[model samples]
Target: MKHTISALVKNRPGVLAESSTAFHNNSINITSISCGETENMEVSRMVICAEGSDEDIAKVTKDLQAMDFVIKLDDLARKEFVDRELVLIKVDVNKDSMSQIMQIFEVFRADVVGMGQKTITVELSGDQERVEGLIKILHPFGIKSMCRTGMIALKRGDE
Candidate 1:
């Protein structure tokens, strides 16, 4: 199973490295991770997505919460939260396929961020399902390149 976890840590230079090392030490199998400063620049939120058994996830969560640098920790996978990821994909294009691709772009609400004669780049942001749907649909267009950001999440309602 996949789990989403977040840790709030002091926005210091070594926080990220140390956090990741802790995961490594615990043998936590991470799938995606992202860290960035919150509105208050003094703190950073690290969002980690990992695959593990229930017991393993519990251990990881407990271990992460006990870290000195971590101010707070939450297992978002079991919380009422929403998450999104951003993807940029460049696909082969030509006059004959332009309209079809454009239609798909509209259907997916993807933006044309960059364009070339032979290829066109698009930006799409959504939850994993929506993002993966777009990529799967665009596969026939011949994906030239792609970039994706790790999932970021916020809980719903007031805490």
Candidate 2:
């Protein structure tokens, strides 16, 4: 099963590396990861996806908390949450086809974040399935390139 863990770690050099190295040593494959500094002191929020059982996740969380840099560890599986990922797609465009593609973008509420002579980059942020649905909708149009952020989530309700 895929497990999502949210970790609060001290924003110090090599902390992330050490934590990831531990997972690597355990033969756990990290499918997605996102990290960013939060406002409270030098702390970072890390979201990691790995294939592990409940017992394995428990062990991982326990091991991580032993590290000095770790502040708190949360297993998102136990919470009600909302998650999203941002996607940027650059699509091939021509003068005649640009207007048609723009209409499609309007339908999906995608924003044109960047534009080049022959391409337009659209940004979409939503649930995983909705994001992929937009991608499928745009597939009829040629895509030059695409980029996606790993999933980020926040638990619902007051903590």
Model 1, position 89, has a per-residue lDDT of 99
Could you give candidate 1's per-residue lDDT for residues 1-159 as a string of tens digits? 898988889888888777777777777888999888898889899899988888878877787778788998988877888899999999999999999999999999999999998999999999999999999999998999999888999998986
Distance (Å) between predicted and true CA of 120, model 1?
Answer: 0.5
lDDT of 1: 0.90
Cα deviation at 144, candidate 1, in Å, is 0.9
Candidate 1 residue pairs that clash: none
> Which segments of candidate 2 are over 4 A away from where they belong?
53-55, 95-97
lDDT values for all models: 0.90, 0.87
Candidate 2 least-lDDT 10 residues? 52-61
lDDT per residue, candidate 2, 98-142, as tens digits?
Answer: 899999889889999999998999999998788899889778888
Separately for all candidates shown, the number of backbone clashes (residues 3 or more apart, or on different chains) is 0, 0
- The candidate that wins on lDDT is 1
